[model samples]
Target: MNTAGEHMISEIVGYISELVPIHVDKTKTELSSIMTKYHVTKVENEDVHPDLTEKIQLFLSSKRLEGLAERTLDGYAMELRIFADHVKKKADNITSADIRVFLGNFPNLKMSTVGKKLFALKSFFGWLAGEELIKRDPTAKLKPPKTEKRLPKALTIEELELLRESCKTVRERAFIEVFYATGCRLSEIQKLNVSDINFQSMSCKVIGKGNKEREVYLSFKALFHLKKYLQSRNDDCEALFVTQRKPYRRLTGRGIQREVKNISRNCGLEDKVHVHVLRHTFATLTLNQGADIVAIQEILGHSDPSTTQRYARITEERKREQHKKYLVL
Candidate 1:
């Protein structure tokens, strides 16, 4: 949503965000009460058209389109409200200048945060243009700011060896191998079912972002651990990965992150060993072994080559060693 409406709408948003356990379907009366309490209505009286709210609700509920996730739909609504305030209240027609004004205020924002807002505006205006709601797109000219090309943290070969050697449970080994083999996002991996695995080919079929399906290969060691884990699985449950706890639902991203951290700590590894690190490790190692960068991009299911190029960059150790050989400094 646009910046002005944000203050009023956010005050009206349920105390706990919808991303958390808080209920998102609060009454307009409840929203008005919140606005009154916060005195946000006084400052932003023209913000968030009530008709636009109904339209957004209808759009989110329709399964024929994207934006299904509850958290995502909520965020989109908030973003649209912000945009509507900025656009509809404009004295003159909205243009790239208005968009520039919105983006220009984010100098103090973190790169990730700035990226999200830009993405929100882009999507909102794109939707408006698609529906013929707008004659022209204000966000059409917006550009994502270039974020620093910091390499993802990955375990060194020795650190990986140490961690792999430290694993006493077959479950731990399976988690590590699956992460490295698939390079799937944590959310994708968490949602994997037993049917997603190809036992004969030793590959995993993952539902990636945008609901795209991609196949990722497994190593011999990865397959070994997976097979071992499968032997202990309950036939009644279809989940590829399950916790030891009762009710036996899917494992969460947080659960996997904690497991990786515990394993890293136990093995005395210095690097932070999260799931994304495992994916980066796979990409880096594969690129180092002469695998094509484009192939790595496909394997990791990245739509952009620029995203994969970060993996193609040399490691710090390699750069330091190269400087030693030059001896000019």
Candidate 2:
């Protein structure tokens, strides 16, 4: 029998079973026999359009060709894949209402997370419209959630000193020093080659987001620890930092994070210490020391001066505290 015929028979059997109060065993046997004879199949939604998949590939290729970092490309791909799966439709067929519904479903997510997802969708749909693949951008009407402004956390000078002292190995000390000195992103530091650093000048070239290269300087203390670390290494991996094991591979971002956490715990720090906090510490300290915002922007590889201005705000807060203590009214 066809699917409709089989479905009708199952419904009839279900009503009969409920009405007659037949034994469960007999009902199961009868249902099994009917299913075997009819060969009923599970229903599934239609597959997403081939054009949608093709467009996604093209978008990724464009990002690669535009010199986006690998990690950034991976994020874009993952975000778009999730959005596509949630919608389960072609890009052109997606509607603003559908996107609103999808985003609304993620109620438990942080505002920043929801904003990131919305930004990804907006970028993807914008690209589709630009390429003329879609008549209208579905995400055009969507607005990202407003996230609360939180100050970046920076370690105190004493805490930094204690953290550095807690490092038992030359490698760990060097890792912490470089992170605090350069203010580079975790991925930028992880991708650093040995040749990128200049010991005499106390500076290194880092590839920031969009594969943009910038120079970041190191402090005398950072240079000293880094030199010590390098002198202790026996491998020829060419990476600035490597694992301690044999065949020493380059250290990954996660490895560096774990090392930082271990050092933080050893130092008895109650607050979390990660690569980004180290960066915030660098920027905050530099601003307090009277470094110009533009110079901080260059050191931190921030494309926008406004991003570097957060440290200036920190400085203002410090000044306000000092004024409160010193003013005699």
TM-score of each: 0.71, 0.82
Per-residue lDDT of 286 in model 1: 80
Candidate 1, run of 10 with poorest lDDT: 35-44
- Each candidate: what lDDT? 0.73, 0.85
The parts of candidate 1 lying over 4 Å away from their true place are 1-47, 58-107, 268-271, 315-329
Residue-wise C-alpha lDDT for candidate 1, range 232-328, written one tens digit per residue: 7765678878876777877777888888787877877636776788888888888766689998999888999999888776767767876798878
State which candidate has the highest TM-score: 2
Candidate 1's displacement at residue 49, Å, is 2.1
Q: Which candidate number would show the highest lDDT if scored against the true structure? A: 2
Q: List clashing residue pairs in candidate 2.
A: none
Off by over 4 Å in 2: 1-46, 315-329
Please list all clashing residue pairs in model 1, or write none if there are none: 1-79, 1-82, 2-82, 2-83
